[model samples]
Target: MPFVWAPIPFPDTNRIDMALTDKRRNWTPEEDVVLLTQVAADLPFAADKGQVTKSWQSLADKLVACDHFDRVVDGRKVQNMFTALVDEHRKFDMASAKLSGVDQEELEKHTLLDELLPLLDEVKS
Candidate 1:
């Protein structure tokens, strides 16, 4: 079941019972860049052979095995994070793809600009 973050108000008294807060381990910006970069890089080599690519769960297992944090996240959360990164990659890919035919050099520049700029912007923020 999903977690509840709201508090329960008392009937008459000025007291309320707040649900215990869930303390999840937070990922750092450096870690985010590392993991996302890994995922993106893996995409190209994934189709190297006619064999099927590994699933997100497999990637999750690899991450968990190598992660330095004390918090142990399950495959599900890792899969979700991977999915979001893939979505962001798709967004960047689409931005570049939109300008594919105007000029070759311009397309390459636009693709590179859109790809790295947003990531830098996000990292700074």
Candidate 2:
């Protein structure tokens, strides 16, 4: 399920429309602008334009760095790690298939060694 801005209220009739919209899950430039604007407006006079902009940008960056951002420049490193783990799992499954005739204990050991070690290695790499 997509994350919802639970603090914000909406009309009952508009629930379906809001839920079905891509805006519910994805962040966009316009929404970022609006969020910055609203947050800036709430700030005291001591906060200058640069300060507000920087704070807003930082918040946006942190949100994007979170797992939900999916594929993007900021997400490349995490995506690579995720892909490597998946690939390692596939390789382990293939290796296990080749040893199908082995005893159950041996198969279990092979499964763990073939899968987890490579996945951990990639994480360290």
Candidate 3:
């Protein structure tokens, strides 16, 4: 069955991202930008490693090394975080796919906003 939320007031914040994390600390988009920059810088080295799995593990290790802005992480945590990021992007893409005449920028705004609305509905016990 479909569920609905009662009408409640929310803050007039510009955007409230639900604070994704490795279950220990929150990761900001700014931190992600820095981490991704590091990944881009290290990707060539990771690519040189033979198998795809090893290369991914190497990347995960690098991510852990760069986790200072957030919580401490290991390869497995990095792997999980990476999977989450990919999943989020894919979900946005899938949502955008069904729409016509929507530009990437608009779609991104809508997708981010859409994700935030539900998160705002959660109440603490």
Candidate 4:
């Protein structure tokens, strides 16, 4: 006898709110570089109290105006993405610090991250 598979019925009324919301897409490397550059350029605005949202919205608008991406994003989305990037950078920086005798050449490879480091430090202070 062959085994039979049955499809489960999903009710429309019980649908999750997430399904109705916009689907998230992954940011490309180019997009990441562009975002980081934009953020670094506007670090002062970002550090200013109560101007973070406006800064992010400005970044989003700049990104959209670049005519590189097909999908549109809002300030919140850009902020979240920047947060994730910063988190990753923190983790990587911490790990690198733990390692002994890392070559200067290797460390210098992450030029973009290095450039943003001073801006981030300034923001913290």
Candidate 5:
């Protein structure tokens, strides 16, 4: 089920508190794919403009549109998730690069995260 952000009513008050009532859930693999795809699409724009938050917000909107995630995702959440993914991929890429006999053509990337490495490298250059 998708997470809903309902306002909590204050007792005897006319105000409603707009805080997240449920704990945040982990990103699913499907959601990650959506996010990565969206990021890849926006890479050139982001590289030229350097507006990461706007790019992340666009990614969040695209992910939410996919309706694959359990909870509502915001730009900040998307940014954090992408940051974590990039960090993990960096470590993985470094370890893989250090391997002596592994040919680039022989390396297999079965996940969206793995596929994102080269695109990220492009943005850096």
Candidate 6:
């Protein structure tokens, strides 16, 4: 998908809450009015395969993700990206901790065994 900046709330209104796509959420007509009014031009991208195109939607998505495009973009995309990054970092930390139990000597032994599986298999038999 092209870059995007969701949409921001109007000057007199609070921020718009972006609901999950699967969720049955509703937006008021007033909110929609504010969203359309504040949305900038050329924020979408048309598919040109190898060629790169820019539009209001793409810019909007990006702005939303960065929190800088607050006026015309949703902030959820940024939140999701951050959440994913945090999850990946946590998983990496867990995996590294689990690997700590395997000493260098044992790792080397396993590496050699893994490399000579056919010969190691013969010996095992």
Highest-TM-score candidate: 4
Kindly list the per-residue Cα lDDT of model 1 for residues 7-107, writing each as its tens digit. Answer: 88658432323222223446654455555554554442243343323444555556667655333455566556555655666685677678866554434
Ranking by lDDT: 4, 5, 3, 1, 2, 6
Model 2: residue 91 alpha-carbon error in angstroms? 0.8
Stretches of candidate 2 off by over 4 Å are 1-74, 101-125
User: Candidate 5's residue-wise lDDT over 30-76, tens digit each?
Assistant: 66666677766666234447576776777677777775655578888
Better of 5 and 6 by lDDT: 5
Query: Residue 60 in candidate 4 has what lDDT?
Result: 83
Comparing 2 with 6 on lDDT, the higher-scoring candidate is 2
Listed in order, each prediction's TM-score against the native is 0.38, 0.25, 0.45, 0.66, 0.59, 0.24
Which residue runs does candidate 1 get wrong by more than 4 Å?
1-23, 44-54, 67-71, 86-125
What is the per-residue lDDT of model 3 for residues 1-125, given as tens digits with 9 covering 90 to 100?
89998889996544443233245466767555544454444442234335645655666666656645545555455556545655676687688789868766644334443443343233111
Winner on TM-score (1 vs 4): 4
Model 3 misplacement above 4 A:
1-23, 44-68, 106-125
Clashing pairs in model 3, backbone N/Cα/C closer than 3 A: none
What is the lDDT for 17 in model 6? 33
Between prediction 4 and prediction 6, which has the larger TM-score?
4
Q: Between candidates 4 and 6, name the one with more favorable lDDT.
A: 4
Best by lDDT: 4
Q: Candidate 6, residues 1-125: lDDT per residue as tens digits?
A: 89899788555322223334323344433433333332222212222433323333454465546432233333443233323433544575477678876753433323332333343245336
Write one digit per residue (lDDT tens) for candidate 2, span 1-125: 99777676666857777656633455443433333333233322123544744544454455456464432332233233334544755786687689877854434333433544454455456
The Cα RMSD in angstroms, rounded to one decimal, for candidate 4 relative to the true structure is 7.7
CA lDDT, every model vs. true structure:
0.51, 0.45, 0.53, 0.71, 0.66, 0.38
Q: For each candidate in turn, give its C-alpha RMSD to the true structure in angstroms.
A: 13.0, 18.6, 17.8, 7.7, 10.5, 21.7
lDDT (Cα, tens digit) per residue for candidate 4, span 11-113: 7753555455435557777777777777777763345688878878887888788776544777888788777887787888788889869764543225667
Candidate 4 lDDT for residue 34:
74
